[model samples]
Target: MSEVGMNKRVMLVEDDLDLAVLIQDFLERYEFTVSVVSDGQDAVTRIIAEQPDLVILDIMLPGLSGMEVCRQVRQQYEGFILMQTALDDDIDQMLGLELGADDYVIKQVQPRLLLSRIRALLRRAAPLQFASSEQQSFDYQFGALKIDLTRRMVLLYGQPVELTTAEFELLCLLAKHCGEVVTREDIIQQLRGLEYDGLDRSIDRRISRLRKALQDDAKEQDQVIKTVRGKGYQLCIR
Candidate 1:
């Protein structure tokens, strides 16, 4: 059992009884407390009530569908959500992220790979522990937008802007390098711990979501975040 998995609660929302049991057993071996909810509605209720550290949510569910469950539970629960889909469908993946899923894994993937994804998401959710706090700035402001890294909060024009964990992290990365183009390769490596395959659209989707939360128009040249054609993205400084 890995010490890092100790005390971590994971809720697996998979309708397949056999698959759920297998995943639960594998995760348990790593010292993670795992709970299984087969119904989407039940998962939402339990997720809100229990607020587990992470949720392994299946896209297809009996009661409410995983997408619906995600939309509903996100109103209250702020924990990490890792969606699962049987097929490698772009629409499903994009919709999952738009609905607040932190990341996703295909059903055919190995259990160990799924475990790796879970660990990556958990690491991102955890607060950064730096040896020297003085070297880092926990707060950043760009015009009407304000980001408080310490509090994991974002405000726009003095009003709180609701953003998922992934969106917030992307925004922070862009803010940290405001006015500088952050390549897709850099973002994938830093945020997802995966090399950019030049085909993954996850980063673009998150950027769109973040822009919407910030009320920034990507079409405008003076937008808060500008797409550097063929390069990546740049957070404009006000």
Candidate 2:
């Protein structure tokens, strides 16, 4: 059992009353203060009003689907989002992450693991004290690649590059620390709110997709993203 004094605040959006109550009870024991809501719309409203530290959002709900709820949360709420989704819905999970959700867990996951996930997310969202202030907004130029964080724009060979939300976030993390090898775990922590057990493949897929949009041709052409075998990834820029 967890001490109430050390409890972290959580907003839970789930339609299943029994599940919701059970989760509240269990998390409370872990020293978490949970505010439960049954509908998606209500969840969205309470998120801004309450400004809780974290949100446990289901993938399906009444009035607004869980996906839509996640979208709304991303647009306004800067807090971490842990999406509860059904098993075997890889596509939906990917979509959720792309839409700005931090991490996803199978609905029937062990309560202990769920708690662990919550803690992990909190640690990631917590700001790094040593992060350079100049890191906030800067223009990085490498060869024909130019990235402007203040303007939220990326250019390759003097051509404007379009990126999805997920891809854009990934690029920012990589480009900001150019030429440095970023481990999959660090990348996952930076891009996703929470971490998954088998997400290295997913991050690779996202990097590949981003590379495609950046006009990186692997064969008979130079590319920006350099893959470090058995290590991670590096963005080599001039």
Candidate 3:
């Protein structure tokens, strides 16, 4: 559970009444103020209006469906959206992610795991606080790689980079610790609240995707994200 007194708001858009109640009760107990919207249309409206910190949206919902709801809410809402999906619905899960969902969890999720995921997403959405006043500005730039933290936009070599939520978060994390070898353990812990189990390749896959997006050659010696052999990854900027 997060520290007391900070009641981060969360909205749960699930059509199943029992599941909604269960999730709501659990989240509230963890110090999050949770609101339940059973219908997808209602969720869209309430989300746009209320602008909660995080949204736990079930993919199968009344009226709009989770995919449609995510698409609509993403247009205006800048906060995180954690999609709830069935294990077999990989296509819908991918679609939701492409639609700007921060992450997706299986529908039959344990409350503790859900809470961990929520905390991770919130951490990613949190601002990158730097000690220097000049570094606190909204825009961060290194050579041709530039990021507008407020706008959540990234540009590489004068071209706009279209990145998914996870990809963007990884890029931001790397940029935040530029020139330092951020260990894989730290990366996974900060990004997902899970310890590196030595077999999880998701972060490595994301780094590959980010390298492609940034046009960085992993084969080259000089690039944005450099693999430090056994150490970890480092973001180097001139």
Give the number of the best model, judged by TM-score: 1
- True-vs-predicted CA distance for residue 130, candidate 3, Å: 1.7
lDDT of 2 at 39: 94
Candidate 3 structure quality by residue, lDDT tens digits, 1-238: 4442248999999989998999889888878999999999999999999999889999888899999999998989988899988773546656887788878888988988888677766764544443343443446789878887654667665556766566888889989999999989999999889899887667777788788879889988778899987768999994
Model 1, 1-238: lDDT tens digits are 3434567999999989999999999999888999999998899889999999999999999989999999999879988999998897768988988788878788857998888777766765554443443354548988877787755667676666766566878999999999899999999999879989999987887798788878898878679999999999999975
TM-score of each candidate? 0.62, 0.58, 0.62
* Model 2 pairs whose backbones collide: 7-31, 102-193, 142-238
Comparison by lDDT, 2 against 3, better one: 3
lDDT of 2 by residue, 1-238 (tens): 4322246789989999999999999999877899999998998899988888889899889989889988887878877888889874658877887777777788977898788677756654443333343343437777777666544556666555655446767988888778799988888877666675654487887888788888776452256888887778888763
> Cα deviation in Å at residue 106, candidate 1?
1.4
Q: Arrange candidates by TM-score, highest first: which order?
A: 1, 3, 2
Better model by TM-score: candidate 2 vs candidate 3: 3
Q: Model 2, which residues run further than 4 Å from truth?
A: 1-5, 131-238
In candidate 1, stretches whose alpha carbon ends up further than 4 angstroms from where it belongs are 1-3, 129-238
Candidates 1 and 3 compared: the better one by lDDT is 1
lDDT-better candidate, 1 vs 2: 1
Candidate 2 lDDT at 142 equals 78
